[model samples]
Target: MAHFSYRGRSAAGKEVKGEIEANNLDLAVEALMRQGVIPLKVSAKKQASGLNVDVSSLLNRPIALEPLVIFCRQMYSLTKAGVPLLRAIRGLSQSTTHKLLAQTLDKVHYDLTNGRNFSSALRSHPRVFSELFVSMIAVGESTGRLEEALLQLANYFEQEMETRRRIKSAMRYPIFVLSAIFIALVVLNLKVIPQFSSMFSKFGMDLPLPTKILIGMSNFFVNYWYWMIASMIAFALGMRMWIGTTTGRERWDLWRLKVPIVGDIVNRAQLSRFSRSFSLMLKAGVPLNQSIQLSAEALGNRFLENRLIGMKTAIEAGSSMTVTASNSGVFTPLVQQMIAVGEETGQIDELLLEVADFYDREVDYDLKTLTARIEPILLAIVAGMVLLLALGIFLPMWDMLDIARGA
Candidate 1:
C-alpha cells in the first residue's frame, strides 16, 4: 500500500493533518472521507531517501531529556484526562516550543492517525525515543496503563537529570583547576623556561642535572610544539577509531569500571540504572526475559551488559533469578541476597527498585564527597609540579652565586 499525506478540515471545521495508507490517491481520499475528514490537499507521501547518510537528520540534534520529561508528563496528564491518542499527539505537536520535538510529534501524530499504535510510531524515531521508552509505552498500551507508564518515565528522567547535574557540578572545580595547571605548564615552557635557559647560557657555567632537564624539556616544547599538537590529534583520532570497534570498546568500558576514584561511582551509577530500569520494566508488566534484556542494554557498560546477557541466558535455561544474578558476578553480595529474597516473595520488582534507591543514595553521597576525595591527590600533583619548577629555575642560580663568591 502507498502512503499519502493530507491536510484537511474535521467535522467541527478544525484543521487536521495526517497520513493514510491506500492503494492510490483516490482510495486515500475515500478513506479520509470515511473518517469524517474532508481532504483539502492529498498527495503521495515522499518515501525516505535512499542515501545511507541523511544530511538533514545529521544536522538535527537529538532532543534533550528535559523536553522528554515534559513531553511524558504532558502525555500522562492528557491521556489520563481521556483525550484520544491521536488528538493528544496532534495538540502536543502544535503546542510544543522545541522545534525538534514538535516536528517529531507531528510525525508521531501522523502515524497514529494512520491507524498505527503509539509505541510502534515512537519506535520509528529511535533518535527521539529510546528502546526503553518505546517498550514502556508498548507495555502501557497492552496493559491499559499508558498514563502510568508516562508518569514513570517522567520520574525516571527527572532522577537521571538530577544525577547528571550533580555530577557535572561536582566535577567543575576539578576541571577548572586542571585547566589552570595545563595553562601554567604551557606558559612556563614557552616563556619562563626559555628566558631562564638564555640567561643560564650567558653565564658560561655548568648547569645542574635538574636545570639541564628543564632546559632540554623547554627546548623540545618550543621546537616541536607543532609535532606535539599533531601527535595529540593523531592519538585522539586513533583512540576514537579503536573505541569504535566492539572489542576495544568493551575492553575500555571494563577498564573504566576499574579506574581509581572514578570507577566506584561509575559502577554504582550503572548498577543504579540497571536496577531502576529492570524494576520499571517488570512493574510495567513486561516479560522477565525482555525486562532483563532491556535493562542490561540500558546500563551503558558493555562488560555488565554482556554479563547480564549471560544472566538472561542462564534464566532462559531455567535458572533462578538469584542464581543467574550471582553467576553473573556483577551484583554485590547484598544485592544478590535481596534478589534471592525478592524471588522467594515474588516481589522482585519492588526489591530491584530498592536496590536502585540504595545505589542512588550511594552515588549521591559519593558525588557530594567527590571533591574531598580528589583534593589530596590534586594537591600532591600541583605541589610536585611547583617543587620541580622551583628547583629547576633556582638551583643554577645558587651554583652561580657560589662561583662568583669564590672567584
Candidate 2:
C-alpha cells in the first residue's frame, strides 16, 4: 500500500490534514471523501533520500515509554467513554506531542476508516508498537474489553518506566565518577606525566621503580596512541558482535544477574516485570501459555526469558505451574508458593499481582539503598588511584631532593 499526505475541508468547511494509505492516489481521495472531507490537495508521501536521512535516528529514535503510557491511559479513557474508535484515534493523533507517534496514530485512524481491525492497523507500525501490545489489543478486541486492556497496559508501562528510572538513577553517580576518573587518567598520561618525565630525565640518576613505571606508561601512551585507540575500537566492536549472538547474549545476561549489588536489583526488577505482565495478560482473558510467553518477553533478561520459555513448555505438557516454576530456577520459593496457592484457588491473576507488588517494593528499597552501598566502594577506588599517582610521581622527587641536599 502507498501512503498519501492530504489537505482537505471537513463537513463544516474546517481545514483538515492527515495521511492515508491506499492502493493508489484515486482510492485515497475516495477514502477521504467517504469521511465527508473534501480533498483540495492529495499527493503520495515522499520518502527522503538516503543522503538526506539521519542515520543516527534509525538507531535511537525510540518512542519514549512515558508517552506510550500516556497514550494508553488516554485511549482507555476515550474507549471507556464510548467514543468511536476512529474519532478517538483522530483526537489522539491531533493532540499527541510525539511527532512519530502522532503520525502513526493518524495512519491507524485512516486504516480503521478503510475497514482494518485495530490490532492489524497497529501491527503495520511495528516500530511504534510491540508484539505484546498488539497481542493484548487483539485479545481485547476479541473479548470486547479494549478499555480494560488499555488501562492495564497504561499501568504496566508506568511501572516499567519507574523501574527504568530507578535503575538509571542507581547507576548515574557511579558512571559520572568513573568517567571523571577516566578523563583524569588520560590527561595525566598524555600531558602531565610527560612533562614530569622530561624534567626527571635531566637529573640523570636512577629513578625509583614507581617513577620508572609511570614514565614508561606515559611514553607508551604518547608513542603508540593511535594503536591504543584502534585496539579499543576493535575490542568494542568485537564485544558488540559477540553480544549480538544468542549464546553470547545468554551468557552476558546470566553474568549480569551474578554481579554484586546490581544483580539483585536486576533480578527483582525482571521478576516484577514478568509477574505484572502475566497478571495483565491473564486479566485481559489471554490464555495461560500465551500469557506466560508474553510475560517472558517483558523480562528483558535473556537468561530469565529462556527459563520462562522452558516453564511454558513444561506447563503445556501437563505439568503444574508450581512444578514448572520451580524447575525454571528463576523464581524464588516465595514466588513458587504464591503461584501454587494461586493455581489451587484459581485466583492466579490476583496472586501474580501480589507477587509483582512484592517485587516492586523490594526494587524500591534496593534503589533507595543502592547509593549507600556503592559510595564506600567508589571512595576506596578514588583513594587507590590517588595513592598510586602520589607514590609514582612524588616518591622520585623525594629521593632527588635528598641527593641535592647531600643527605
Candidate 3:
C-alpha cells in the first residue's frame, strides 16, 4: 500500500484535495470517487517540506500528559455535544498543533473512515496512547459511555501533571542551593587554597596539617579536573544503562523507597496512581484481575508492581482480594483496611477513589513542607563547608602570626 495525493471536485462541485492510502493509483482514485470526489488527478504523496524536519525533536520529543489531557477533554466535549465520531476526529486532527498527535489523529481518522472502531485505531498508536488508555477507551466504546471514560482520563492525566508540577516547584530551591555549594567548593579548591598555599611556601615555614591537606586537594583539582569531568560523565552513562535493565530497575525502585524523607512520599504517590488507575478501570467495567495488572504496571515502580502482580495471581487462585492485599505488603495498613471494607460492601471502586484522594492529600502536604524540611539539611551542609574552610585555610595563618612576633 502507498499514499496518494488526489485533487478532485466534491459532490457539490467544490474543489477538494487530500491524501489517501491505497494499493495503487487506480484504487486511490476509486476510493476518492466513492467519497463523492470526481477525481481529476492522483499521484504518489511526498514529504511536503524537507526543511521543516528537526532531528532533535524527532529523537527527544515525547507526547506529554498535557496534550493527552486536553485531547480527552476536547473529545469529551465534542462527543457529549453529539458530534459524529469520524467528523469530530477529523476536525481534531486538523486543529491540533502538536505535530505527532495531529499525524496520529489523521491516521486514526483514516482508520475510522475504513470502518475500524475508535479504540482499534487508537491501539495502533501505542507510543501516544498507553495500554491503560486503550483499555479504558475500549470499555467506553463497548458500554456506550465514551464521554464518561474520556472525562475520567482527563482528570487522571491532569492530576498527574499537577503532581509533577508540585515536585519541580518544591525542588527548585534545593537545586539552586546545591548548585551554589558546588560552585563555592570549586572556587575554594582552585583559587583560594592555591593563593594561600603559595604565600605559605614563600615563608619556608612548616605548614599545619589542615593547610597541607588543603594544598594537596588544590593541586589535585588543578591537575585532575578533566579526570573528574570524565568520571562524572562515565558514571552518568553507566547508571542510565543499568537502570534500563529489568533487575536494575527493580532494585532502583526498591531503593528509592529506603531513601530518607523522600521515600515515603514516593511510595504514597505510586500507591495513589495505582489505586486511581484501578478505580478508573473498575468503574469502566474492567475485570478485577485485569485492572490489577494494568494499574500495577502503570505505577512506575517495578518492585511494587511485582507485589501487586502477586495479588492478582492470588486472586486468580481463589484468595480473597483483601487477603492478598494485606499479604502484598505494598499498601499501608489504613489502605488495607479500606480495601477490606470496600470488599465487604461491594463498593471497591468508590472506596478506591477515596484511597487515591487520601494519598493525593498526603502527597500534597508532604510537598508543601518539602522546602521547610530540606532547608535544615542544606544549612547543615553549608555550615560544615564553612567550618572546613576556616580550619583548613585560617588555622595555619595564626601560627605564622606567632612566628612574625618571635622575629
Candidate 4:
C-alpha cells in the first residue's frame, strides 16, 4: 500500500489535512469519506531527491523522552476522564508541537476511528511505539484497564528517562575534560610546538628525549589529523552497526557487564528495570508465564533477554520463579533470596516492586559516587598531561640557559 496526503473537510465543515495509507488516491478518498472526511484532493506522498537532500543526516536527532512521558500521562488522564478515544487522540494530535509526533498521533487516531484497536494502531508505527509498549497496551485493552496501564507505562518511561539522565550526568564531566585536553593538544601540536622546534634548531642544541618525542608527536598529528578523525568516525560507525546485530549485541552487553565501575551500575540498573516491569505486569493481572515473557522482552539487553528465555522455559517445565531466577545466574543471591521469600509469602508482586524501588535508589547513589570519583581522576589526567608537555618544552630551554651561563 502507498501513503497519500489528503486535504479534506469534516462533516461539521471543519477543514482537515492528513496522510493515509491506501491502494490508490481513489481508495484513500474512500477511506477519508468513511471517516466523515470529504476529500477535496488526494495525491501520493512524494519522494524527494535533490542535491541538497540527505536522508541519512536526519538520523542524528536525539530521542527526546520528556514529550513521550507527557503524552502517556495526558492520554491516560483523558481516557480516565471519559473522553472518547478518537477524540482524545485528535485533541492530542492538534496540541502537539512536534511534527513527527503530531503526524503519528493523527494517523493513529484515524486508524482507531476506522475500527483498529489501540495496540494495532500503535503497532503500525514501530518507530514511535516499541514492541513492549504495544504489548502492555494490548494487555490493558484485554483486561479492561487501559487507564491504569497507561499510567504505569508513563511511570515506566519516566524511570527510564531518569536512569539515562543519571548515567549521562555521571559521564559528562569526564567527557568534557577529555574534549578540552584534545583541543589543547591540537593547538599545541599545530601551532606552539613547531615554534619551539624551530627555536631549538637555530640554537644548535640537541633537544632532550622528552622534547624530541613531543616534537615528533606534533609533526605526526599535524600531518595525519584527517586520517585520525576519519578512522575514529569509521570505528564508531562500524561498532554501532555490529552492535545492531543479535550476536554482536549480546557480546557487547556481556562486555559491558564486566566493565569495572560502570558495569556494576549497568547491571544493577537493568535488574531494577526488570524487577519493576515484572511487578507491574503481574499487578495488572497478566498471567505469570506471559508476564515473565513480556518482562524479558522489556529488558532491552540481549544477554538478559536470553536468560529470561531460559527462565521462561524452566517455568514451562513447572519450575518455580525462585528456582528459574536462581538458575539464570543474572540475579544476585540477595535478590534471589528476597524473591524466594516473596513467593512463600504470596506477595511476590509487591516485594518485586519494593526491590525495584530499592535498586533505583541504589543506582542513584552509585551514579553520584561514580561521578565524584571520575571527576577528580579526569581532572588529574588533564593536569598530568599539561604538566608533561610543559616540562618537555621548558626543560630543553633551561639546559640551553645553563650552557650560556657556563660559557
Maximum-TM-score candidate:
1
* Residues 197-262, model 4: lDDT tens digits: 888889988888889888999989989999999999999999999999879999998998899778
What's the TM-score of every candidate structure?
A: 0.86, 0.85, 0.85, 0.82
Candidate 2: where is the Cα deviation over 4 Å? 1-60
lDDT of 1 by residue, 36-76 (tens): 98555676677687654646676888788899999999999
> Deviation in angstroms for 279 in model 4?
1.3
The positional error of residue 209 in candidate 2, measured at the CA in angstroms, is 1.8
Better of 1 and 4 by lDDT: 1
> Please, what are the lDDT tens digits per residue for candidate 2 over residues 140-211?
999999998898889899989988998898889889998998898889999999998998889887888878
| TM match of model 1 to true structure | 0.86
Q: Which stretches of candidate 1 lie over 4 Å from their true place?
A: 1-53
Off by over 4 Å in 3: 1-60
Model 4 stretches with alpha carbons more than 4 Å out = 1-63
The alpha-carbon lDDT assigned to residue 304 of candidate 4 equals: 88
> All candidates' lDDT scores?
0.87, 0.86, 0.87, 0.83
Model 4 poorest 10 in a row by lDDT = 54-63
- CA lDDT of 296 in candidate 3? 85
